[model samples]
Target: MVPVAALAAGAAIILSGCSAGQVSQTADQVAAINGNTAEAGSIALRNVHIVFPGSGTHTNTAGGQAALALSIINTGETVTDELTGVTTDLGTVKITPADGDKIEIAPSETIVVSTPSAGAETHTTGETVDTEAGTTEAAAIEITGLTQDITPGLTYNVSFNFKENGTVQVEVPVDAGIESPRHESELSKSTTGSAGGH
Candidate 1:
């Protein structure tokens, strides 16, 4: 039989070793972000996510439209980049800038992309912020002709192409709000009501 002291020492070693050689999942070690993030050259896409088509828990049907929201940040100190186009296998992306044909991101600047308002198509709104670094513009992004159903808790692949940064493919998820059980139940009721109305 093993001695009591040896057994106690072995248990202590095992317990201490459990935390060794493992990465910490605490907030200090990893950032708590709601959306996915990706990088393309000096440009970084933050909070990349797709908006659910409707308020209900029902999934967006195939060939329906959804909105993509993200912020494009140019980390370069001097080099400027232009977002030329965005594409996805699930659908075609339409980017509308408040001004200009392409969305421009000046050095050390950020451009925010948000979902279009209800009953509006290709909506873009932003204010010109003239800073010492450069001007920042806000744009709107919409994905149309989606070939697959878009539902909460699912991720879809989308590619963003920049004139200088090239392209970066990001797997984006649906909005985080609908992920909650309470929100899901609310959506179910609303979806049922809408279906009965129509």
Candidate 2:
């Protein structure tokens, strides 16, 4: 027994609620990252992850070597900083610079660090520096004598010691190498099929 105006208003409200697009619809459409990040003072470490040993191998055995990959950014406008060293309970981190023993980062500069020894097949973040462009410098951060297996889905705590920024501890993960949701779904289907056969 509602009035015509009331009924129309109700209908309008219902139509508005059922409209096409929504902010919540886009909520699930978010960006995904593979690595962890940490900030200390003016320095920010982005995409800190460990490269799995060799291509096709998903795990690195204990006591073996693993490469740590990350980009160190100096956010300060004027103050230059130096990466003094890196340490972790997992192993000893050797910082091999392209030129000298010192890893220097000028203000507003980014130093890309990775383990080149792991070879190009497995390296995820450690990219080669373009010497022709002569813009960014690259260094190698290798973790040797690992106490535990370095595998995907496991995170290890690593400390980055900067001369000016002190020390920042970051929990870094090993790369699983899954690039998209479809890839994950396909793998899941195959896994399900395998389980059903057993």
Candidate 3:
């Protein structure tokens, strides 16, 4: 026959074991319930527009320096999670005519950000300068660091680096296929053109 104290201790051990099992079961159930409800969200950039400062022909002496403006509407619902970094891939930023010059773009909001174009000093004497004739430069604007959340129905503006001869600001339109140069090895050698801009 066991002593009364020993019986009490044994019963207590059994109760504790039961309690632990119940707690583990409850936790497993809660996790299973949440697993089904979890879903992934998305973000989209849309209605992008890049505009040149002036439609008039830029002088070759002004070093073909010009300004480019851009407007873009970022339309997408924010994720419950946070995005740390969002950036645009502006290919090799360089001034036209290979004058060894460069462009600089001052960062700003949705409004115009002034980026200088290449000047005439960058071009050779005999070269007939056109918008594309000048050296094309590329610079990426980092948008991810600006905010914690890029919420739905919000617009963010990013400016490219200035080109010495002239600035080519691209307006990335809605669903515009702005390919990533980092992935394309060939883009490193290809020249950037003014295909779509205002």
Candidates ranked, most accurate by lDDT first:
1, 2, 3
Residue 11 CA error for candidate 3 (Å)?
Answer: 99
Q: How do the predictions measure up, each by TM-score?
A: 0.70, 0.70, 0.18
Off by over 4 Å in 3: 1-102, 105-133, 144-146, 151-153, 157-198
Q: Judged by TM-score relative to the true structure, which candidate is superior, 1 or 3?
A: 1
Summarize candidate 3's per-residue lDDT along 38-126 as a digit string, tens digits: 11122222223322223333221222322222221112222122222223432212222212222222121111112223111122322
Taking the tens digit of each residue's C-alpha lDDT, what string does model 2 give over 1-198? Answer: 469989999999988866456644665563476688899999989888887565432236788777877778888988889999999998878888745678888787778776544542332333445433233577778877878887678898999999999999988898775442344565465553464754
Query: Model 1 scores what on Cα lDDT?
Result: 0.75
Which scores greater on lDDT, model 1 or model 2? 1
TM-score of 2: 0.70
Q: Which residue runs of candidate 1 sit more than 4 Å off their true CA positions? A: 1-22, 27-29, 54-59, 116-124, 128-136, 178-198
Candidates in order have lDDT scores of 0.75, 0.74, 0.27
Query: Which scores greater on lDDT, model 2 or model 3?
Result: 2
